[model samples]
Target: MRRALLAITGLAAGTTAMVVLKGSPGAAPVAQDLPAERPTVVPAPAGPTPSGGDTAGTPQPADSTASPRPGRTATRAPTSRPSATTRAPSAPRTTTKPPPAPTTRTVTGPVVENEYGNVQVQITLSGTRIVDVVALELPEETAQSDQRSEQVDGRYSGSSGLVVQRQSADVDTVSGATATSTSYKRSLQAAIDRAN
Candidate 1:
């Protein structure tokens, strides 16, 4: 029995030794006919020649994983992009204003006669404001022979500023013509009121 056990032990040791000698159990194995991990060197794709590009070109496969052919334009590569500062600028808002008022000028006489036909008056207006009043060209019947031709008569009884600014008008002498002068004064007042 010992002899048989010894024989079994010897056989097991011999098998282990054989495996080690074959470079598998104890040492790293040597791969037979194994391929190397070299990088794939595929070519670029072909395209139409641009205005100034070279004419010689080769076509490539459409699959993205396939390498591009030599002398081919790369369609998938990124070209140009815009910077952050070149967008359109914004504008400010604005407002407008209104127009001004109108101005006026002076107007003068349409000479008029009064009742009993002895006195006359003329008026001047400065834009609806009475500026002058005058008694002019009186009749001989209401005037005295001794009174000067240049003398003013019928008393300035209207707006003092308006009457004083006027050129004095001659007085007419119509005997018992006091009502005529009173009428003349009333007419002058009417003209001034109209202007106002």
Candidate 2:
């Protein structure tokens, strides 16, 4: 903004000076007749102009349109400005992703036994929330026990099961697997406690 302001001020000053100098008596001969449109012709600013500018045949500066009586003419060199400064590109920055999600891990509980058989629970956790549960061991001694165990596992274990949804062992027992369910809860609660 400052540079632009300075440039405008310089241009205005230069134009005013040129008009005063060119129109002043002794600079040129007075015209016997005036033209229709007095168009002001201004040159490239206080900047570089092409070399060999003045034609060898003409006495006046190339800017003048009239054939003026030959006299002394003066010229000054344009001022040069320093180019804008620039910095070299710096090394690429190293960016790192946030340490992976604290990672979900499975924690096993101490074995808990009941009349049915020994029960052990494994819970997969992320932070403090239970994400999944698995009954590592359940009674499979008899056909009835196997069926009952499956009922207990289906209701309380797996990713979308009661243990994970409730995020705790406080779940309703399966109809035919009371003892197995109770054992499962005890083991799951212990596993959760260890995780925390």
Best by TM-score: 2
Q: What is the per-residue lDDT of model 2 for residues 40-149, given as tens digits with 9 covering 90 to 100?
A: 33343454444687644333234544543344232334568665675567999999988777677889998988887899999998877888888899999999999999
Off by over 4 Å in 1: 1-116, 142-154, 157-177
lDDT of each: 0.50, 0.80
- Where is model 1 poorest over a 10-residue stretch in terms of lDDT? 145-154
Residue 68, candidate 2: Cα error in Å is 50
Q: Where in model 2 is the C-alpha error above 4 Å?
A: 1-100
